[model samples]
Target chain A: MIRYVIRRLLLAIPTLLAMLTMVFVLVRLVPGDAAVSMLGDQASEQALDALRARLGLDQPIHVQYLTFLGDMLRGDFGTSMSSGRSVLSEVWQVLPYTLELTAAAMVIGVLFGLPLGTFAALYRNRWPDYTTRLLSLTGLSFPGFVSGILMLLAFAVWLRWLPVMSSASSDPLTHMRNLALPALNLGLIMTAYITRVTRSSMLNVLGEDFIRTARAKGVRPGPLVMRHALRNALIPIVTVVGLYFGTLIGNSVLTEIVFTRPGLGKLILGALQSRDYTLLQGLMVIFAAFVILVNLLTDLIYAAVDPRVSYAK
Target chain B: MTPVLDIKGLTTEFRVKNGWHAAVRGIDLSVNANETLAVVGESGSGKSVTALSTLRLLPQTGARISRGEVGFGGRDLTKLSEREMSRIRGNDIAMIFQEPMTSLNPTMTVGDQIAEGLLIHRGMSRTEAAKEARRLLDEVRVPDPARRVNDYPHQFSGGMRQRAMIAIALACRPKLLLADEPTTALDVTVQAQVLSLLDDLKRDRGMAIVFITHNLGVVAQIADRVAVMYAGEIVETATCDTLFADPVHPYTEALLKAMPRVDRKAESLEPIPGSVPSISARPAGCVYAPRCNYVQPSCAAHPSLVPVGGNHEARCPVRADKGEAA
Candidate 1:
């Protein structure tokens, strides 16, 4: 298993590098002048040139990519072209907020989705099963941002329970309060996807003759879910969850906008708007690398859940 | 001897896309103390369903016992509440299943899997269960039980795993043991060994056993009484000797013939002409009329079971008096 993990980690490096390279090159190709966006129309040509030289935008694409690649290798992400702040510092500052929301959303999704899906599988075709299906369908249909906006309108605007729109600061313990609604909103779609995958996989596992053995052994519902059903169902749900995490990192921009929180998503948007080449490339690379690393962790987890998956090569 | 387990009119149904699919039609049989009653049938012939129904282990929405009385030790198990049923399962009435490879949990150790019932049903502490589990493994003839018990299910071979299953089932000294094709999946040598083990356990403990199988050889070797099931109902039932020697129903005859015997080498094996009838395509009256050898016009109207002799019965319009076909 240690060998398998090491091999997987090794393989992931090239993949992360390739992904970041693609995002960097693609973002650069989009028609925009970072210096012009930073200086705006009011700044003199000489001032823009000076700013370009300072940000290393004066160099050719190949030279700039080489420099960026070198700095990345050295763990330096350079400063934001718009704000003149260290890209790494900005990323560190915003990551907790994003992590807080995503983590809570994931927890909420699993807490409700796993059991509901298991129930749907256990009592398939019954009222509970039908209700779960209906709820999942509704969840899948509504976008997270739409749900977040509706929640903000309902809770903050009308009920005055939550603050209307503030870039809420991240707190470890109480961050849940600020993130709960946004998390649920982001989680609605994930919950649906996970629940659907789980229900199918749970049904398949439950139908196996082995489940009969567990039942005959008199293992109760909760233990049965934890031990037999969920573990087996995870083989498929793991793939969906892994892919969802990547999409979650990417699509979080809209959710952050809706919730009025300072996170990776808002930073990414700012970088894109101002054509902050250094910061944008750095952010993209960081996001891509982080996502790849998380996926690698998820793969290891999936292997642990299923023994047949070797990860040998 | 008092019956350790009694089942009457055990009919089971599953809700389907169109309507309810009757998985197990009306059937009845019982197992006396220390006796092994083998309910023999092909796959999907309701043998497994009957066993699951007795334990009330079928998935709730998919299946229901439309009519039945599973009387165990004077209590109607079919009528028992969920709590009472849960108490009965794996405690008073234990079951060892087929597919020994998958039957045991992959993630857990063999000892923990066996000890699970002890802790859950018997209320034994983990330490106590672990200690007793090693002893039980030793009893099942597992080698190095002390160390082997700590090993996971995957570490054991096919035979060893089945032995572990038996240990789990017999842990609480259940009065009635339900074994669903315990040896059907095993090889010949393993099958013989498992049968012998089951026989020995039954004899020693005087525990009644409901052995489900399609293999007549295993039944002949182990069962005290035999219930020959066709399309979800018991078509014929008799003492092991009588059922084998003077098999009455055509389906029973076909099953006996279907089995490959070592005593005789025949020119060509007679494969049953058609496939087992589907649950969806069940005929109006007779379930096995399309497949029977001595099938008659009256056979179209399904024959209810009637006594042919003392403690021997069959379900056929044309009784065995009109003997074998041709």
Candidate 2:
């Protein structure tokens, strides 16, 4: 298993290289020069020339690309043109906020979604099932920003239960209070998807012969559903959760903007506005790395949950 | 001696677009201690339904035992609460299903499945159940059971998986085992092996079996008595030898002729002329009358199961007259 994981990590090298190349090319290809955007439009031509030289824009394109790759290989992501801070350091500063938001959203998704799904499946075609289906449908229909903004209005402005802006407070309670609204905004969407997947998977598993076998063995309803049915249904559930984790990462950008949280999403948006090419490219690399890592984790989890998933090959 | 199980007026129904339809209608069956009663029929003949109804294992949606009294251990199982029924299920009565490939839980170890019954019904400690699970595996003749006990169902061959299922059913050492075509999904050679294993286990344990299958050959091997079912009703019941020697129902006669046998030529194999009637569209008269070879004017009226001779009964008025004349 360890060897398999190592091999998978090794195979990701080409993918990472490709993603980096795309970020490098695409960031440069966008309209506006990084130096021009960093300085005011009224700046003198000589001042612009000096800034371009300092920014390496005056160098040959191939030379600049090689320099960019070399610096990346040596763990230097260049300086943000707007803030003049190292791009890697800036990314590190905001990484935790993004990680915590996504993680919290996932936790909430699993916590509520699994039970709601199981409840729906168990009481299938009944009122409870219908009610949950309707609730999940509503959750699915709303986009992250719409929900995030609405929650901000309802909880922060209307109710005054939460802060309008996410505060970088030292108090743990204040920190969590700041996280609650945005996390839920993304989490509710995750829940809706998870609930649907789990319900269908559970419905399918409940009909299996093994469930009948367990019943014939006098396994009570609780363990029969939890142990027998849920364990068998877990492959699809875990897959959906893992797949949606990537989607949540993407959705977190909109959610962070609405919640006014200082995160990778906010940093990347700032970099994009100022045409901070190096900073934007660095963030893209991290996002691509996250996608690769999540896929690996999903595969590893499949092996853990299902004994039939052999890693020997 | 009192019988182990006596089922009467067992009618199971399934909901369809039009209305509820009887799948297994008013069938009577009994199994004595130390005996095997094979419920033999073609697909959709309700043989499997009878077994499921007895255990109350039918799906809650779309299917129900509309009326029946499953009398086991001096109590009507049909009337028992779900909790009470569960106590009897794997404790006093156990069941193994068809499809060995899908019958056992794939995610769990074979040993865990066997040990589950031991843990729940037998109240054995975890360690004790684990040890006993290995013993049960050995009993079923799973090789290297000490190591293989930890293996999952997918790791085992189809035959081995069925054996593991048997090991689980026998874990609680119940008085009855409802084996619903337990060998159907296996190869012919594996089928023979599982048959012998079940027979040996039945004899040693003195447990009565309700073996549900369509294979007459399997009936001959495992059954002391056989009940022939057609269109959700028992058309005939007799001792295994008697049923094969002198089948009183036309349906039973055709079934025997249809079976492929080593002594019979390949070309001589007869297929029953038409399929069993659909549950919803069944005729009010004798259920098998349309497909039956011995169609008489009297067959328009539903025939009751009546005794023809000693321990032999058939549900055909016309054939019952023939038996009397002979």
Candidate 3:
């Protein structure tokens, strides 16, 4: 298992490099001049040229690309053009917020999705099943931003229970309060995908011979579904959850925007608007690493849940 | 003596496109303590359904025991609430199914699967149950019981896994063990070993067994009494010896004739001419009339199981009279 993990980690290097290279090229390809965007279009040509030279934008594409690769290899993601803070440190500060959002959303998804799916499979074609299916369908159909906005309007504008805009408060309760709306916005979307995956996977496992053995062993309905059926159904559910975890990282952008919260999403957005090549590339690297990490975790969880899956090979 | 399990007029049905169709129709059988009753049948004969119905383990939606009284321990199991029935299942009445490869949970260790019933019904502590599970593994003759107990089902061979399944069913020491073709999926040598193991377990535990299978050779070896089922109905039931010697029903005789033997040429084996009738398309009168060689004009009506001779019953009017006349 250790060897397998090491191999997977080794294989990710090329993937990370490719993503970094792509971000390096693609950010430059966008139709905007980084120096002009930073120094306003009305700035003097000489001043813009000086800013471009300072930002390393005046160099040829290949030279800049090679320099970026060299700096990345040395663990230096240059300072953000707008903030003048180290890109790595800036991303590090906001990474936790995105992680918090994804983790909270995932907790909500599993908490609600597993029970709802098990209930649907058990009742199968009855009202509970139909209701859950309908709820999941509605949840899936609504876009993350639209739901995020609806929630903002409902809780902040009308109810006045929450603030219209979020702030980086130090108080735990206030921080939690600030996090709730955006977390819930992404959480509901995740719940939809998880519920759908869990329901179908559970339906398949419930028909297996082992399920019959469980029943014949006189296992109670509750444990039968949760332990015998759901445990077997977990591989697919975990796959969906891990895939969505990576998605939630990217998806937090809209929720962050709706709530005006500070996070990696906001950081990346600012970098894009101001054409901060260093910060954008750094954020892409983080995103790629997260995707690889989640995939690896998903495979490990598969081995944990299923005994037949041997990583020894 | 009161039988450990008495199933009367048990009719299990499955939902077809039109409506409910009787897969097992008006079946009555009983197993006394320490007796092995083999219900032999071809595929689709509703043998497995009968076992599932007795435990109320049939699928919740598509299938149900439409009519029946499963009498056990002075209680009508069919009338008991699901909550009450669950107490009896795996405690007083346990079951092991065919397809041992898939019957055990892949995610659970062999010991945990066996210990589950002990924990659930016996109220044994986890450690105590673990100990008992190890003992069960030993009882089933699984090698290195201490180590093998922790291995998952996939690690065990087909015979070994079936032994584990038996250990799981026998964990709670149920009075009635419904083994649905327990040996059907094993090798011929493994089949004999499993059969004798079951026979020995039955003797040691004095638990009644309702063994469902298509193999008469297995029945002759392990069954105390045999019921020949054709198209969801018992065509003949007799002592294992009588069943092999003077089978009264045409279906029973045909089934015996089809058995392959070392003494007979492979060409001499006669496959039963036609298949068992589908539940939905069963003939109104006799279920096996179309497939019976001794089928008579009077076979247009269903025949109830009637005594043919001492300790023997056959469900064919023509054959019953012929046996008596002889």
- What pairs collide in candidate 1? none
Q: Scored by CA lDDT, what does every candidate get? A: 0.83, 0.91, 0.89
lDDT of 3: 0.89
Candidate 2 lDDT over residue span B1-326, tens digit each: 98999999999999989599999999889999999999999999999899989889999889988897999999999999899988988889999999888989999999999999888988999999999999999999999999999999999999999999999999999999999999999999999999999999999999999999999999999899999999999999999999999988999999999999999898998888889999999999998888877798988899999999889999998889776564
List residue ranges in candidate 1 displaced over 4 A.
A41-60, A168-181, A187-193, A303-313, B14-23, B280-287, B296-301, B317-319, B322-326
Q: Can you give the lDDT of residue A227 in candidate 1?
A: 81
| Decreasing DockQ order of the candidates | 2, 3, 1
- Which 10-residue window of candidate 1 chain A scores lowest in summed lDDT? A165-174
Candidate 3 per-residue lDDT over residues A198-291, each given as its tens digit: 8899999999999989888889888998788888999888887887777777788878877888898898888888878778888887788788
Which segments of candidate 2 are over 4 A away from where they belong?
Answer: A60-63
Best by TM-score: 2
Query: Of the pair 2 and 3, which is ahead by lDDT?
Result: 2
Per-residue accuracy of model 1 over B1-326 as CA lDDT, tens digit each: 76888889989998777688788988888898899999998877899999989999988766889997888988899888887887788898999888898888776788988898899888999999999999999988899999999887778999999999999898888999999998877888988988898899999999899999988888999999999888888888999998998888888888878788878676444667787687777888778888877778887786798888778888886865643331
* Residue clash pairs of candidate 2: none
Q: For model 1, what is the C-alpha lDDT against the true structure? A: 0.83
Rank all candidate structures by their lDDT, best first, as comma-separated numbers: 2, 3, 1
- Mark the 10 consecutive residues where model 2 chain A has the least summed lDDT: A32-41
Candidate with more favorable, higher TM-score: 1 or 2: 2
TM-score list, all predictions? 0.89, 0.98, 0.96
Q: Tell how far residue A51 is off in model 2, in angstroms.
A: 2.7
